[model samples]
Target: MMDMRDIWIVIIALGIGTFAIRFSFLGLMTGRRFPDWTMRLLRYVPVAVMPGLVAPLVVWPAATDGDFDPARIGAALVALLIGAGTRNTLGAIFGGLATLYLLLWLL
Candidate 1:
C-alpha cells in the first residue's frame, strides 16, 4: 500500500500535468494561427481519443478470479450498435449502461 505522502505526490503531479496541458494550449494559441493541417488534425482529436479511451475498457474487463470479463464486451457491442444506428450520445450512454446493468443482473 502507498503512504499518504505518496498519494499526495501523485495527486499533485496529476494537477500539475493537467494545468501544464491546458496552459500549453492557451499559451500557444494566444496570438499564433494554427496551420491548416494542424487544425484538421485537431478536429479528429476527440474522434481518435474517445475510441482509444473506451476500447480498452470494453476489450479487457475484470473477472471474479482475476480474468477478463465478457459482460462488458457484450454491453460495449450493444452500445456501439445503438450509437451507430441512432448517432446520439444520450442513446449510447443509456444503451450501454442498460445493457451492462441487465447483463450484470442476469449473470
Candidate 2:
C-alpha cells in the first residue's frame, strides 16, 4: 500500500508527464507541415497501432485467464478476413464482434 502523499505525488507527476507529451506535439507542431515521408509514415500509424493494442487481448484475454480461446482467435480471423476483403472498418468490427459472441455462446 502507498502512503496518501506518495499516491498524490505520483498522480501529479503522471498528469504532468502526459500533458508534456501531448503538448510537445500540439504546441510545437501547430503551424509547421510535416515532410512527405513523415506524413506517409504517420498515415500507417492506425494500421500499426490497432494490431499492437488488440493483439494481446486476442491472444491472452483476461476473461480466459490467459488460456488459449478459439472464439477470440476465430473472431480475429474473421475480422481480418472481412477487413482485408472488403476494406470496410466498421463492417469488420461488427463482424468480429458478432463472431466472438456466437463462438462464445456455442463453444
Candidate 3:
C-alpha cells in the first residue's frame, strides 16, 4: 500500500507540472508574432481538430455501449448538412443536438 503523504506529493507535483507547462507557452508567446507560414498552419488547427474529436462519437456512441446507433449517425449527418449549407457552427450544433434528442426519444 502507498503512503498518503507520498500520494499527496505526487498529486502536488503533477499539478505544478501541468501549470508550468501551460504557463510556459503563454509566458513565452506573449506579444510575439509568428511567420506567415506558421500563422497559416495555425489557421487550420480547428479544421484538423474538430473532425478528430467528433468522428468517433458519431460512429460509436458511449451511451449506446460503443455500438453504432442510427440516431447518432443521423444527428451527425443533419449537423453536417446544416453546417455545410448554412456555414454556421451554432446552427449545426443546435440542429445536431435537437436531432439527437428527438431521435433518442423516438427510437
Candidate 4:
C-alpha cells in the first residue's frame, strides 16, 4: 500500500511532467514554423488517431467482456458511411449513436 505522502509525490511528479510536455510544444515552439511535410502530416493526426482510439472499443467492448458486439459494429459502419458521404462529423456521431440505440433496443 502506498502512503499518502508517496501518492502526493507521484501526483506532483506526473503533473510537472505533463506541464513540461505541453510547455515544450507551446512555449518552446513559439514563432517557430514546422516543415511543410510535418505540417501536412500533422493535419492527418486526428484522422489517424480517431480510429486507434475507437477501434478497440468497437472490436472488443468491455461491456461485452471483450467480445464483439453487432450493434456497435453496425453503429460504426453507419457513422463511417455518414461521415464519408457527407463529410459531416457531428452528423456521423449522431447517426452512429442513433443506430447503436436502435440496434440495441431491437436486438
Candidate 5:
C-alpha cells in the first residue's frame, strides 16, 4: 500500500547513486595504477567475497529452519577440498551440489 510515485522516486535516486559511485571510480581511476599492497589485497577479494556470499546458505539453509545439517556441512567440506585441490571454481560448485544432492537422498 505504498505510493507508486514514491517508489519511482526512490528507484530513480538509487539508480543515480549507483551510477555516480561507479562513474567516480571508472572516471577517476582511468590510468592510475594501484599500489602493490592494494593490488595484492584486491587479489584476495574473490576469496573473501565468495565465502561471505555463500557461507550463510551453507550454514543456515532456508529449507532446514536454520538447523545444522550434517549433509550440508559434509558437502561444504567436500566442496572446499575439491576447490582447494583442483583450484577450479566450477568444479568445486558442481562437486558441492552433487554431494549435497547425493547426501540429501541418502540421509
Candidate 6:
C-alpha cells in the first residue's frame, strides 16, 4: 500500500511536470504567431498520436502465462473496422468491448 508521503510525492511530481510542459508551450508561443507549416503539422498530430498509442496495446496485450495474447489483436481489428465504418468513437469502444468479452467467454 502507498503511504501519504508517497502519494504527496507523486502529486508534486505530476504538478511540476504539468506546469513545466504548459510553461514551455506558453513561453514559446508568447507574442509570436506560429508558422503555417507548424500549424499544418499540428493538425495531424492527433492522427499520428492515436495510432501510435493504440497500436502497441492492441498488438501486445498481457497473457496469463507470460506470453503475448492474440485476442487483443482481433478485438482491436474489430474496433478499427467499426470506427472506420461508422466514424463514431462510442461505436468503436462498444464494438471492441463486445469482441473482447465474447472472445474471453469463448476461450
Clashing pairs in 3: none
Models, CA RMSD each: 2.8, 2.0, 2.9, 2.2, 2.4, 3.5
Residue pairs with backbone atoms closer than 3 Å in model 2 (clashes): none
Provide the global lDDT of candidate 2 against the true structure.
Answer: 0.93
Question: How much lDDT does each candidate structure score?
Answer: 0.81, 0.93, 0.89, 0.91, 0.90, 0.82
Per the 3 Å backbone cut-off, how many clashing residue pairs does candidate 4 have? 0
Worst 10 residues of 2 by lDDT: 45-54
Q: Name the top TM-score candidate.
A: 2
Give lDDT: candidate 1, residue 50: 67
lDDT score at residue 13, model 4, on the 0-100 scale: 100
lDDT of 4 by residue, 75-99 (tens): 9999999989998878988999999
lDDT of 3 by residue, 45-101 (tens): 776787788898988778889998999999999989998899887898899999999
Score every model by TM-score: 0.72, 0.83, 0.74, 0.80, 0.76, 0.64
Report residue 68 deviation for candidate 3 (angstroms).
1.8
lDDT of 6 at 42: 87
Q: How many residue pairs clash in each candidate?
A: 0, 0, 0, 0, 0, 0
Worst 10 residues of 6 by lDDT: 60-69
Q: What's the true lDDT of residue 29 in model 4?
A: 86
**Candidate 4 backbone collisions, by pair:** none
Model 2: per-residue Cα lDDT over 30-101, one tens digit each: 889999999999888877887898799998999999999999999999999998999887888899999999
Using TM-score as the measure, name the better of candidate 1 and candidate 2: 2
Best by lDDT: 2
Which sections of candidate 1 miss by over 4 Å? 31-33, 63-68
Model 5 misplacement above 4 A: 3-12
Report the C-alpha lDDT of model 1 over 1-107, residue by residue, as the tens digit. 99999999999999999999999987768888989999998987765776787787776644445456667877888888988899776788799989989998988
